[model samples]
Target: MRRESPHAGPLRALFRQFSAFAGVGLVAAVAHYGALIGLVEGAGASPVPATLAGYVLGGVVSYALNRRYAFDSDRPHREATWRFATVAGVGFVLTGLFMGLFNGRLGLPYLPAQVLTTGVVLLWSFSANRFWTFRP
Candidate 1:
């Protein structure tokens, strides 16, 4: 076997993987926060309820994109949905925490909180989906 460079192989691979996952996550977050803002401000839904609805929609979009594009998980549909839900539940907690900080404490408003929390939870969500939810 050829000797690998000290900081080339794994590091480069990790960077590429991170880039791709981050890209997909960005799209999913857009779907989530878009729905959230629309539901809350436009529809006059409560902040918490709007966030929950957004989470559900985001979870669905996230599973579809991440499975086919991000991790390429090919497991059966039912099993995959179960795993996806389990992973998403963790992200939901993180989302809620940051949202509470903004909406409850900081009073920064809904859209800003949603954007910030999406960034905070992106890495965690990607890792959980890759290692746990989509793993063989």
Candidate 2:
């Protein structure tokens, strides 16, 4: 039998972790999007405030699920919460910047712009949280 690459195990583990994180993020996204739509369409709320509310809701879900499931992090609440918040704050800014560049400047449609922004933010969030917030 051929020998396995030295990096294969670590790379596989990282991919598994990323898969778990994405699952948690998908749940959070559904929560965020549902709340956003409800607030904007049902309650006649403006997009900004509704978006903020939805983001906060999603963040809460993300933190709880990620702590227990995604990273299996054992960091105390005080430490992890603040780190996650910092990462998320930066993520929000990145989202806006990406959206501006993709949609405002490039004139792409809203949905496609949001999709691109989401991909960028997903990478940023995963990297930051993996290295900083949930680092062992």
Q: Per-residue CA lDDT of candidate 1, range 1-136, in tens?
A: 9987898988997677678777777787777778888998899987766886788787887788777777777788888888888778888888888888888789988777777877778878878777888876
Residue 54 lDDT, candidate 1, scale 0-100:
88
The Cα local distance difference test for each model comes to: 0.79, 0.82
TM-score against truth, every candidate:
0.84, 0.85
lDDT of 2 at 119: 82
Note the residue pairs that clash in candidate 1: none
Model 2: per-residue Cα lDDT over 60-89, one tens digit each? 899899888889998998999999999999
In model 2, which regions exceed 4 Å deviation? Answer: 44-49, 103-109
Cα TM-score of candidate 1: 0.84
> What lDDT is reached at residue 77 by model 1?
81
lDDT of 1 at 130: 72
